[model samples]
Target chain A: MLKKVLIANRGEIALRINRACRELGIATVAIFSEPDRPSMWVKQADQAFCVGPGPVARSYLNIPNIISTALITGADAVHPGYGFLAENARFAEICADHGLTFIGPQPRVIAAMGDKATAKRVMKEAGVPITPGTDILENAEAAAAAAKKLGYPVLLKATAGGGGKGMREVRAPEALEAAFVTAQAEAEANFKDGRMYMEKLIERPRHIEVQILGDSFGNVVHLGERDCSVQKPSHQKLIEESPAPALSDRIRKSLHTMAVRACQAVGYVNAGTLEFLVSGNDVYFMEMNTRIQVEHPVTEMVYGIDLIKEQIRIASGESLGYAQNDLKPAGHAIECRINAENAENNFAPAAGTLTGVVFPGGPGIRVDTYVSTGTAIPPFYDSMLAKIVAFAATRDAAIARMERALRETSIEGVNTTVGVCLEILADKRFRAGSYAIDFLPQLMRAGVS
Target chain B: MRALASLEGLEGRVRALAAAFVQSGLVRLRLSRGADDAIEFRRRASSAAPRVPEAAVFSANGAPERLYDVIHADLVGIARFSRPAPAAGLALESDRELASVEALGIRTPVRSLGPGRIVSVLFDDGAPVEYGQPLFEIDRE
Candidate 1:
């Protein structure tokens, strides 16, 4: 058994992991940057270490400092709580090299899935539906040819990416060249890999992802699917719900089976998510995130399983404690990411001290957050301040509960997307589960007054 | 002392002042008793301190002329007896650095009370500064 675990991330995810560790009778060491020293996660941990300055590169992303803190603190394992070095292969390698268990997949698995093109290829081989596209294009001519083959309204994506960065959509031959060059340059600048690939953009598709957990022994099972279609260009997920409302039972089962097969094929171990773009009955694998997802709470609430605990168990050489038949979705759950950003201001990050915080609490409402009254929301990190998730016996009930929760929720000092989330919940398209990936952006563009 | 006010009330006052300061950049005013024994005011400075400047001199008036001359002479000596020096010997996390005296938007020279590292660069340009608030962090190196 690992005696101590160091959370190599921050915010709500870190607090989530700390809760799991505390329940499992495991000690936790929290690593925080200067601005995060006063955060709830830092105070909740058994021990805390300062890794570096406020900038992510100097602090959270400084793998060497994180590992050193873990070593100095005598932590036996490092749990990267999503983002930063969570999916970083080099960080995992360093953890293993230091004889500290990395509570995720092996470095190789992270490396394979970290590259978008390679993950797609692997999933394709595993009989997963993938968007039709070409290999990394060599030049503008190759990109143009690939776009023609894939049809217009195709997407130019970075081979090594996620988070909507380095992605461009071209609707016609006239726009293909410019989109390709711009995307390539962005890819090179962002990922240091100028490699770009073309894919058929599934118009008006819903973003659905399956949560999968496995152990080193090849046992893989999916928790369920989540609908993350309501998102802005900033890639901030506005709303997510489990059992993806419109997905039929047949499609859900198929998606789960495909997700499990993909995990088994890759010999994946630990908590991971397989993302897909769903349009009508067709589901295409987009990519696999090799870390705990930001919206894991909904699945946890509906499934009654502690995913972070499972991750720690798997990393500790323990086989999955539960079988596939034991897992069943219990209730409908929905999550709204309350970010400290001004939706009317192009989602610009809002920073200031949180003068007041009122989180809704009742049966079935779960809030995962590190903020408190008087907490200063530092501007150096992601703008997400809290996640409000609610559960009920049915989807409609859950939606209503979430709406109430949002109304009851308040955070002063920073302009947040709480108002926007309320608007989305009341949106007829969203309520009817008919919204697409472009729903939030389109609604914002129309000016939801 | 006046009756204590709610945070919202204080925040409203801060907001009003901050907005006015931002709009005008600086405002100088003097408070005096008029012939009718009413408060009179006049503008003095073009800009308010970036943040509320420290009460350098605690006298009913602002800084005394002697203290002002001392500050104008050996700026480093200000750290020794400055009304609000940096907190010393506090157990801070590794990532925390000493506040940057330069970044607080304060125009005055800031000397280290003892020793510390630069943690956050709150302000970039030399602006007016608030006193007693965190400027930076100093870890036991």
Candidate 2:
């Protein structure tokens, strides 16, 4: 097993990784920006180093400093928790060059899966179900032709896009050309790549993703699927639950089998997530995240597995001793992302020193966070405050437990989405477990009752 | 009574005296037990301990009292001074090389930012330094 790990990011995910390392008896070295000096993760770490200033480019993204910190501190592995350099293939290569194991997939896998168009093509070639889509379009004429074949309301997506950037849904023929130009320009400005693809937009689909883990010895297993349909208007997930409520057993089993098959096709190792858009009986491949995702807790709670520790063991060349049939995931788990943003005012990020912080506890609840009273929320990073998850015997019980957990939570001195999440829990559509990606946005638009 | 000439052999005592003088915040110190037993220590305008908040202080007549420049490490590595570390009171040019931090076989040089007299060297040679760690304090008054 790896002896030491350097956590290469900040906030809640950093703390999550630290907890895993501690439980595994591995020493941890935390790299933080100057503004995050007082963060709980840094204090909990065996050793901490300030990498740069407040800006992400100079701090968390500074490859030289991050690598140097790892080297100087005698760390044998690096865990890029969720964001920053988590999916950066070059950073993984640098870690390997420096003789430190990067706790993720190989650089080649990351690069291949990071591109949306390439991922779809690879999945299609592997016999995974994919939506009808065209490869990277060359010109506006090509896009128009592809859209005509795919039908109206086709979506224009950037090959290298995320967070709803450089994505547009064109509902009619006249909107295609302008939408393509705008999307191309936006893609260039955002990702420095103007390549675009066309897909038949799946309307009001449930965003379900299967969590899979593969070992270097070719062993792979799927934990389960998470329904992440509840999302903000910007396509950010707000709530995620395991076992995807209301999904047919056939579809769920197919998703799991396909996820493992896809990993085998790419020889992928480490933990990965394959996202799919489920519309009625048709399930279409969306994309694959090459690193451990933010919603991994939901899968972990239900499957009773420690994914971060598994990533370390796999990266250390340990073989997975268990087979697919040995695993039996039980119970239902739900997670609510509590972000420090004004949900009523377009989710404007709020930054200030947190006070009166009270996270819920007791039966069937897990709070993963790095905040406490007097923790200063800097404006340089994402506004996520905590991830409150609850596990129960059934989906309905899980939802009720999550509601109680959210109510018991209170964070002072900054705007939080606690109220919005409570309202979502109370909504009838959400209680029925039939909501889609548009559910939260429509709820917000109608002024959350 | 100890002669100033005899004090030359007591290097440790002289260092202790300097420390005491800096701690006392006195501009100068002179101790004499006899005509031949005399020793003196003098501090520049800004050489006292707890460096006056790091900002430029002004005199009553409007002239700058003292301006200091603190140099910090830009990367993390083991600091290696190519030569002897700049001692207190050593005058240096802006571009003079003080040390280099070596990591993964790459050496990143740490240089003096401006011409100034060395007020203090915070870290020792071969110390493991992290990014933004203070390395040197220069008095540019």
Isolated chain A TM-score, each model: 0.95, 0.96
Q: Highest DockQ: which candidate?
A: 2
lDDT of 1 at A208: 93
The digit string of per-residue lDDT tens for model 1 on A264-283 reads 99999999999999999888
With candidate 1 superimposed using the best TM-score fit, by how many Å does residue B78's alpha carbon deviate from the native? 34
Interface RMSD of 1: 14.1
Instruction: Please write out the lDDT profile of model 2 over residues A1-449, one tens digit for every residue.
Output: 89999999999999999999999999999998877887899999999998887889989999988998998899999999888999999999999998999999999999999876678789999999999888889989999999999998899999888888999999998998999999999999999999999889999999999999999999999998999999999889999999898889999999999999999999999999999999999999989999999999999998889999899889999988899998889999999999999999978899988899999998999999999888878888999999999999998899889988998998999999999999998999988899999999899999964
Q: Can you tell me which runs of candidate 1 are displaced by over 4 Å?
A: A138-144, A158-167, A174-195, B1-141
